[model samples]
Target: MDHTAYIAILSVAFLVLLQHLLGLANRNGKNKSRMRRPPTPPGAIPFLGHLHLIKKPFHATLSRLAERHGPVFFLRLGSRDAVVVTSAALARECFTEHDVAFANRALLPSQRLVTFDGAALGTASYGPHWRDLRRIAVVQLLSARRVGCMSGAVCAEVRAMVRRLHRATTTAGGAVTVELKRRLFELSLSVLMEAIARTKAERPESDADTDMSVEAQEFKQVIDEVFPYVSSVLWDYLPVLRWFDVFGVRNKILAAVSKRDAFLRRLIDAERQRLDDGDHSEKKSMISVLLTLQKLEPEVYTDTMIAAFCSVRDSFVAQAEIDAAVGHSRLINADDLPRLGYLRCIVAETLRLYPAAPLLLPHESSTDCNVGGYDVPRGTALLVNVYAIHRDPAMWEDPGRFLPERFEGGGRAEGLFMAPFGMGRRKCPGEALALQAVGVALGSLIQCFHWGRVGGVEVDMGEGSGLTMPKAVPLEALCSPRAVMQDVLQKL
Candidate 1:
């Protein structure tokens, strides 16, 4: 009785174990078969995966890989899987058809550090919070109406910059050699500050103006330093390294964030005080607008979100457009922006050649999707190579040449192929404001000054290493007031 019972129990246990193993094997095989992963480049190594293939100026490296592996290819960087879309067709698919699936941001370590752990509009994941931030950004801060109201501020800043450059020319005793990139950055920052907070950026006679408040100067420096490292930090792809803080990048980022937050707090405090004092004389700053909304929806519009809102050189068919539309009677104003269609084209063209964010803020897929007919798994980091898409020879006739006419009368249509500020639901909301600021500033410069390359040398135009593609060599050029506009310039 004991032998028969033991044998029966053993047989039943063995059958159950065999069935379980067979079911496990079938499930594993089915899962593998269902997932049609995108084509990944060869030479993926253990642990490191394909991270070694990624190099500085990552957009170019990804573009080169796309040339070999195809426009839409998978990459495994450390423990993360990424899909790089380098062609317009694939990019279109990602933004259009698969837009919702890939609407969320890939919150990298560095981005989290700079953005108050994804609290900022640009860094926040796609969700109700993001929607609220975006709504405030679009409807309140960056609407065409709001941007138009702030045009006075933009014009005032541009005029001030022109005056500064004019003073430089007089001081130099002729056409002066000016490093334009720093000036451009200063101009951009000033316009943004004035528009957002109704406060002027006090320039202390030099770029290294010691007279500037420590907080102000430190804030500016943090901005300059943090932007380039936002996406390029080692810990972005290799999260494990963050614990070690091997290069002290985390510490540097923390310090920068602290300074940034402090500076923003000061601005917010000042705005609140002014509001409390009932000084409604000035046009309300963007900060004030957000604060009003914050009172209604405190949960959505936090100080960090308001602070986040507080965040180029270009071409000459542009000049002719400006001349034709604006003439020499008065400096170009935001009112003239609509008529200066060709000038807008030039801006669009410049962005195409050199997008502000070369590898646009990375996006993450919320669900499995198909891009360019390739399977994109959920949680895959999506990098759209705007630099490559903009310059893809397949999409453009003479993609390398600088031709604003390519955008003539069809610039908006061409936006599908170009994404300097990104595309789809998650695209940068500041695009309108940026264009307004840059268009007026660039146009005024061209209208008031005759620009030439210094020493008869070509402008370097080589791209630098940064999230924003700065010039490796800051643009230095010779400048003098246009003879016809001297009267207008002198009045300023």
Candidate 2:
């Protein structure tokens, strides 16, 4: 070949190689650029932003994130935006300082249909109507006086539960695998119902006694399958879904809601009939109080309004279902109240560990503000993870241990940091009733039985999803009569 021809061929070959190398460099450069972007927090894998974190239990994922990202961090799950708060200081800010600003609940799709246009106090927006309804709820249903008056019911139910436990133990060869969660739920339910029903005698154990394993399992299944899905309905945020109602998800919820609403209507109707017939007295129930308000102030509050306000429909009654299925012991009646300190501690601990509203009602910033040094603009959705805060090591001495003594006297639970009921103006009005019910129940349980785990492994204190963090495994315990050693309990 001629020298010029050789040089031309060589030049063409060089150009081709150079182009290939440059293309490779650009591709590699793009890959490196992507890698350089801070790996989206811990627990996230390629192409999925924090999806793996949610697959595991919620508490574990949150605990892991808290460890890596300090107390607070931003997260996204399938296009949903969230900020997790894990410290008491931040929780305090969300609960108190930011109370009014964050009072409005982030509208949940499931409750929107069921809550009578968001009229229920728990899900309602912060407004004049909300304030008025809350006022009535606190004064009428959840007031200290109302809860205190229900002490007799608490005593009655606890005694009944003890009697049932005694019967089960005697019947089952002295060792019964009694479901503590359901029993406790029923106890709480009985008191709440009796308080609402104003019933004097102990409520009858249902034909399908909630204590039985089959009924307990069914109750749990209904809650577990139905609740979480309903709460996170895809349509709430996505407007496009509204036109077609999106994927038939709304229909399923509506069906479930209809069934639930029917159950509540029956309960309410029965209560109303008693009032109409003059069978109810000054010892009126919370429902009756609501009915009275509706009658007296027909303009502001009507029967439907009262029903929406205080009715133990699926939204509220499901809590009782969950409480029963989860196996906390029943609420103690008045006679056993003195000795059931541990039950109170358990309720406190449960609230701490598995906050009913872990993130709490999402608060919208009314105006631009700086919280924890980050600029939070108005219209931002604020979430405070009470679960993370309760278990914070800095705030708590031994956060994970189910130690109730920390709250015993002038201790960690007695001050600013301890608020399971939330704080400030938008605080939960049901605080008084929950405390009274939980305390009396716990006291009675301790007084009546010697509670210990059934499987012998430490009670699996693992938590599950819900409005409340319930025991992953309902508490199954062997209840032995405490009356034999009543003298010792009396001393305490």
Cα-based lDDT at residue 414, candidate 1 = 49
Listed per model in order, the count of residue pairs whose N, CA or C atoms clash below 3 Å is 0, 16
Question: What TM-score goes with each of the models?
Answer: 0.88, 0.75
Could you give me the TM-score of model 1 versus the true structure? 0.88
Q: How would you encode candidate 1's per-residue C-alpha lDDT over 371-447 as one tens digit per residue?
A: 87777878989999999989999878899998777888775674547788888999888888899998899789888
Q: Give lDDT: candidate 2, residue 321.
A: 30
Candidate 2 accuracy as TM-score? 0.75
Q: Could you give candidate 2's per-residue lDDT for residues 1-492 as a string of tens digits?
A: 899999999999999999999999899678546432211376644444465466435555776777877766765553344556667777677656666776777666667877776888877788998888888887777777777676766666656666677667656756678887778776665665567555443323543354323322333444454576545654554445668863777777777666655555655777788778886466677777777766778787665566676511221232333333332444334434344443455567667766666656665566555556554544556666666777777778788776655666646536726656766666778776677666655554554556666767666777666556676778777776554434433332
Q: Report every candidate's CA lDDT.
A: 0.81, 0.62
Sliding window of 10 residues with minimal summed lDDT for model 1: 207-216
Provide the global lDDT of candidate 1 against the true structure.
Answer: 0.81
